[model samples]
Target: MAELHGTTDDRNEGDASRGVDRTLSAVLASGALGHSERRAKLLRYLVARETSGEGDKIKAYAIALDVFGRDETFDPNSDSIVRVEVGRLRDGLRIFYGECTDPDLWTIDIPKGTYRPTLTPPRVEPVSPPQPAHLNRWALIILPILVVLPLLYYAMRPAPAPEPTAPYPVLRIAVMPFEAAGDHPNLEKVAFGLYTELSLDLSAYPWIAVVSPLDPNEIGADYALKSQLLWQGDNLQTNSQLISLPEERLVWSKSYSIPTTVEHIQDTQLQITSGIATSLGSENSISPDLIVARNARNSKPNLEGFLCFISTYRYAVEPTRTEHLRLRNCLEDAVDAFPEFGEAWAALGVLYMDEVRFGRNPRPGHDSWAEARAAIDKSLELAPLRNAPLMAGVVLSVQAPVQDLERARQLGRKLMELFPRHPPTLALIGSLISEFDGRWPEGHDLVQQAIALENAPPSGFFITPAFFAALQEDDAAALAATAPLTTRTSETELLLKYLAAARNGKTEMMAEQRVLLAQKDLSSDADLVEFVKNRRFHEELEASLTSQLEAAFLVKADE
Candidate 1:
């Protein structure tokens, strides 16, 4: 019977492979290939290798030899022709799939790092368009009912018996159901939302493994996070605690108050969730004491990877060539040790891009852009929905040597669709779209959404709005926008201040800004102009920035 099952499985896979082959033939014949003989041949060779069960063995050397007529002397390190052609093939496949109306067909992709093609069948049904706001009122009407049923079911279910403690270098923490401290309308829903959202936010940190429906047996998780929600006037307060399992020792605790209006219950939930997640996982904002202690006691590869990521984030905050090289090596090691770590791959991509930004690509003959693109692609493939990978992809698409405006827009759309309320993605993508793509109105709307989402956004978030105000010659508006960003010491911040000061005719302030900018490396007129141009500001605003920098430099030169 076992042999028969194996035979049946193999037969099914064979049938699928045949179907995929047919689909590939159809794609090749279609106009989607656009008469590119090279792309067509490349696709054919890759599919043939994959269908023959030699996908794992497919390599650039093999492709160059078989398809590109490269001699045995072909060197993949020196010659990027194979990689270039494969990229075109990927673009061709994307076009084909975009035009493909057949939902039943398999989609082919030649993922980075290898020439083997992956043929994946569509697993998800197309989502139907959402009903209008008036129609969605039905969902709101039934929302309380939906919320109560789940609570009732959970309350009645017998508690999971505690299991034996599981060993771990990677710690597992369970999120138990949040308890309500007092009777309040919709308090049950709020508690449920906290439990769900907190679990999701904590899981964003790749080093920590999160388990739900806490097993009392402690079989999988070493720690448990508990929360209590209560009403305080118009505000909702959430008090959270983390306890070591088995020992039942309190490890960490925090209290948060969120103003909850009738219309903003969801926002209240997000606020509470974000607070807890940041305190527990964000290494930069709040020291996650538990994670810090655990890693100090027993430093493991995954923990090291997380630490490397923290270092990477710091480099973003305060960039230096020394820190850049160190982070590059650290992330490279982390990825090599644990290839599946998506955060590490994302950070590695960022470091690669930073090297290019600072004009410090360490490897002489290698293509850093290609390396960055590959690392970013791998990260997205590993963790598509995560903020880090998405942000890295967005950065690459816009800031890399070869900008992909379409890809940037696609990533931006995904961020808005999946994480509409996420402030970091909103602010970063909004700024990029506005500054790089010149889609100011749409981008500004996203930036406003981010501002509304977070009370105290970082100074970077204000750059685009300030620039826009300056462009319109609204000096007051520009100064008001730049006020919050005064504490920042970056070149960009100094440039913003210079622009605002110049607009207001504050000669002293403008001189101070120039001095500050010079300290940050823009010392001369040529240097300032080049720096502004290197920023690749949108075409509409580039002339204004160039003119401003040129004028400032001329003043200093005359002085």
Candidate 2:
């Protein structure tokens, strides 16, 4: 009759007699079952079957009939009534256990992917007080001195008149998260990438200070910058706004459509950056001479293939059938337009590899894998170790169905040696691959260095640290890293909250997350996981990492 698994029993008549009474009493009187009659009936049915070791027979069809009055001929696939009610039963158990304060109580749960009910006895770790008496004593002695010294110093100083504030408040501009126009995960990445690029570009002006990625509406900044990113037809459309927060009006707004070919990407970016800086009317405006000088360094700003390559590069970040087909077609046209463009060929190769990895083919059994190899080889032949080809080749090394981790590592080292002023995007992707490959310490340091080198990393960059904290099982660190992320809502944000809440045993806090996750209209759990982890493409990448680990172990053994 005892709820705990290791309860004392003679394993004879005494045990047999007690179990019958215990099972019945636990089922009929349990708080989890005391609520809705239907839920109670379902719980009793599941629990009774489980205790008698016939739990396997209590599948969805059986439960539908016995608990919900479904006919024997009921089809669970067509009728979601059983699924819906079972979900409530799970929530009911959670609610029951959440309200119970007893530390030693055994709670019932129906874990995901199964119908069996489990009785779990609470296992509590005993808390201990801090034992470092020396540090505690030092804090007591220094606390008063630290407080009084500041007060005494202030009292002896003469107060001066406050300085006049600037009329425009130095044009403090806060960049809100760029809105992604689609539900696709790839679009989210593209939006975030653009957001980071714009923030970094704008921050170059001495008069502007980019606010942290919090809600712009709540901030008291002089100006607020916001953007909406969309991929429609053959162009990347960005609707940007510079708002005067004090006046509560839009100061400047422009909608730009950059061709997917990306020929004028740098020019478009430069224009937006300079436009905002010039419009601010600050003394430290960017010099027109410098803009001209910067443009002069861009060798082929009007190149047809490179512009298309830019859009293709961003599109492949997280790909789908319709978009990737368009991407591949665009890449083909780019190559045909500029046959000598090595980067275009490399891009075409990467696209084919990714399409194969995603199980999408332009044509059935087209042998894209072979085409990918040939195209990549030809690209390297045309522009060996050149910046454009090298960048494209490195991404292929990391992302293709057959990852060349050695090549990726070499490229990463070579990139650092070359010392690009800003290579944070590559650093970010490498860090992701490191983490995915279970090299957590390496990944953590790589991301740390990347963030330190660039002040305005992509908005999604925050997830790296949160993920690191989660892997280390450091709940407090995870919570702190995720605290700044409360200004937005996404599946990623929700999953992070759920993780942090679960680690702290905040079941009440998890209630909303549970509801949101289980909403009927929410996408499938698998898709949500993929979106959160940024694994929209190359679905089997992580699975391959497992084999990589095994191969690594074998190499270590041989060594």
Candidate 3:
């Protein structure tokens, strides 16, 4: 590699020094980049090194050791604090100066794949996009058993059933007596049949408990499902409404009309049950009947482990008195109960990251990050399917402090080949598309494929497309991507709205969402992440939002 050169003594050194100082001051003053203390330090450290004529001495390892406080044996492959921060700093610098800094002033850059800082006078020419910061030649694909494991989960079992009384308050549904109105002969039979089907379908959800022939006093459940049946000409019409208990809030209501035949009743009930269960927070595509049947005959040890794994997965993503203890206990219980549960180990790796990511690890008695890293390694060793561990590794690779991007990119390609149309597969790789790798086209395509694959994907599925659009400054595309989430009132919904409105210069819409965010008590990006109820959505969204927040599309509105 060529050493970086500067003409300090020969070419306006005093003026250049003053220009650098002025620029650094502007960068640190904005909420755009300095919100992250490490980013600010990275910029300052690089600028200082350049000013002192020590740019050639700057290396990835040195930055890792000196600025980021890494130890002597810092590994570029595993601990990527320096790499991720450098990438952010580069992007932030462009966005900050593009919006706030003067055009005639100096432009400073620490180019990708190197730590050397370059300072140059303003030029009118357009610069080519920088390369990805940690681009390494990806290792050859190693097909592992974890490949297509998400598909295997389809074959494994349907879903959840435990005592309704767990420590956590679960979503509950009480299928009240389906009333038959006027000329509704054999209506009781239809109502009873629908009740049985509803009970079975709703019970399949891991977080949902069902109460049959619900009594009025069952206030403990979170929600209640009620319906009325009417004969509409040559058809049976089932009108259903899901209501929140105690609060009496209308969650969702729908009407379904199908032919009054045994075949239609059976098939239509399944469809309606599936729809209702989904609205109640079950995002898994598996039908409720499948879940009910699977849990009924699951092997004891495996079932115990699976239950703990699902619970841990839930607790990790969504915030709820969340301190990482409950998730840790759940994963520990899974591995202790069934030592062969590799998915549990993979999830444990994510939870260990939860400590560092969420401030759960301050001054640890143990090396939690190392332990977390080992968990994924063990998961890869033991997992019968590769997708679970591979996906977990992909998440770790995405600016997560100890990122493993090359390995993740390799695994992502393998998973993409194995399960092209799987929602999870599309969701994972699609969210990772970046200008850095020139993968945004493929990434956006995958997200679109995922959207096409599922008729009713979760609200989080729209997130990746919207994010990619925002970062690219395609405000129209960003608005188009978030059209699906407009009806819902979620933290993510509010976030996308704020982003779209802010980027589109829809000042009134932006102001409206800002109020909604305050109502949700989400004060920061971290707060928005904590409110994430979807794991796939959270990891990918968190990965991109940091840089997106620093980009030029958004305007600061009057408070």
Candidate 4:
């Protein structure tokens, strides 16, 4: 009889046929049939079944048993073997289709119910004849040359190496505000006079960055410098003093209390300023008498100017009109006494900006912007590269005639580079970026680094970490981070307690906060505003605490 071919007569012929191609292809590809001979035999058996197509379900199971023989019972119902083989077969078909271009040579089809194969003649396509070997000899030789040329070029080319990095620059410094400690009423004034004069003398040095005595807190305690002059005084007697630079191993130990008379004060200040310059090995030493005479000539010595510096520095940390006025008066006197004081002018500019920011100084009617610009301009003229003047420019760029975010960013970056590990610089930049620029994560990181550089001090600095943490909405983290420093019985602690309790869902903690608020006499809106401004809690917490305290106080008043 001629070879019989399979027909799709059963209800599930397509399914079976599809499964057979997939299964046979899988078994052949898996190398799981022990030998190539067995694999080939199994494939042949599957193909034979496809072509015959005469087996009923029972006949199919019997054929499977016959192929396996009695050595191992065949299992038609075992899903583990069938699924694994089917997966392999599907993968094989995919690979074949991917590699083969002509579909007419042979095709694998899975119909509905039958596992079978059918043979058909291959379709042929017309093609051009191959060229003679002698005609292609030169082409073959040139093909190798083309391939080798690329290889040779690649071998000869140099591989690029990474660029070398530059080392961090070294910093120089000088410490000031070496106020004397003493019992004599005027002794402390004399000590401060010495500090001021010495600082001025040191400022003449082109390389030295004189540490201003205006606010010791803002400059930070930790700094690396080649030299430092620590001017300290005995609290009991200003006449007794010690001027020392631990790095230089030098000390100017002295005891001389001058009366508060104008002459004595001038003489005292002159002696110390010139003496410090000589001790520091300065080539040019200022004479004590000249220093005294010069100070006497400017006898007022701009106390207002000094105060302005202090007020501006304080306002930087905690802004207020009272402080602004204090700064204005000081700067005015400072400018009068010393027209060349660039820092004072810069500070004046910043003070005006503060006024404008707080709405105390109007824009159109008030000449605050003009005053600020003029002051900053004069400051820059005097000290072109000074940090104070540069910072003034940065402030103006952000708050004055033009708002330049890029300039502000550049100034901040340069400042940090010049004064690495400077806490106030870091804090200011971090706060600006965090609050105005919407770069919260960077701001938060910068502020946290600033706090770390500050050595985690218990004072106003504690609020840095707390503020950022609250902004991030990580109240528990904020509480834990701030717990150690918030122990002092101040507004800081009260705020911390309130936030910790509020976040922890502790009603009792809130009640305790109420009690503390009452004890501290934080009843008025002004007092509350100050408290809120100085604390670590967020606005929501501040509002909640204010309301709770108000209610609790009201009830107490009724009783």
The model with the greatest TM-score is 1
Top candidate (lDDT)? 1
lDDT by residue (1-559, candidate 3, tens digit) is: 1222542233356666676688777667643352345667778888888777688778889998888777898897655456545654664565456455367567777654477878775545668986565543321232343466766887798675553221212333566767776454444444554554455445544334454423422223345688888865567788888877567788778887787654566566666666675565343233444333211211224433544454543343344434357657767887777666676788888777766554453336876677777888787777624455767777666535445568778878766654433455667677765422436666765665455333344566677666666565567878766766653346656777777776677778776776777766666555655544223333444456544444413365242
Model 1, 1-559: lDDT tens digits are: 1111111233366557666778888787654543345566778887777766677667889888998789999998666567656754654565567556677677788764466777765454659997888877799889899999999999999998765232112334667778886655445544554465465465444334455533532232446788887875666777778876657877677776766542244444455445545544553233343333210011124544645664554455557777778778888989898787776798899888766665544678878889999999998888787667888999999988778999999998876665544456677888899889989887876675555333235667777777777677666777766775754457777888887777666778888887887776677767777777777777788898887666655555554
Q: What lDDT does each candidate get?
A: 0.66, 0.57, 0.59, 0.49
Q: What TM-score number comes out for model 4?
A: 0.42
Q: Ten residues in a row with the worst lDDT in model 3?
A: 291-300
Question: Which residue pairs come into collision in candidate 1?
Answer: 161-217, 162-216, 162-217, 163-217, 163-218
Ranking by lDDT: 1, 3, 2, 4
Summarize candidate 4's per-residue lDDT along 224-277 as a digit string, tens digits. 112222223321223323233223333454555543443554465566545544
Ordering by TM-score = 1, 4, 3, 2
Q: What's the residue-level lDDT of 306 in candidate 4?
A: 44
What TM-score number comes out for model 1? 0.48
User: Model 4, stretches more than 4 Å misplaced?
Assistant: 1-179, 182-324, 336-339, 356-374, 392-403, 456-464, 481-501, 506-559
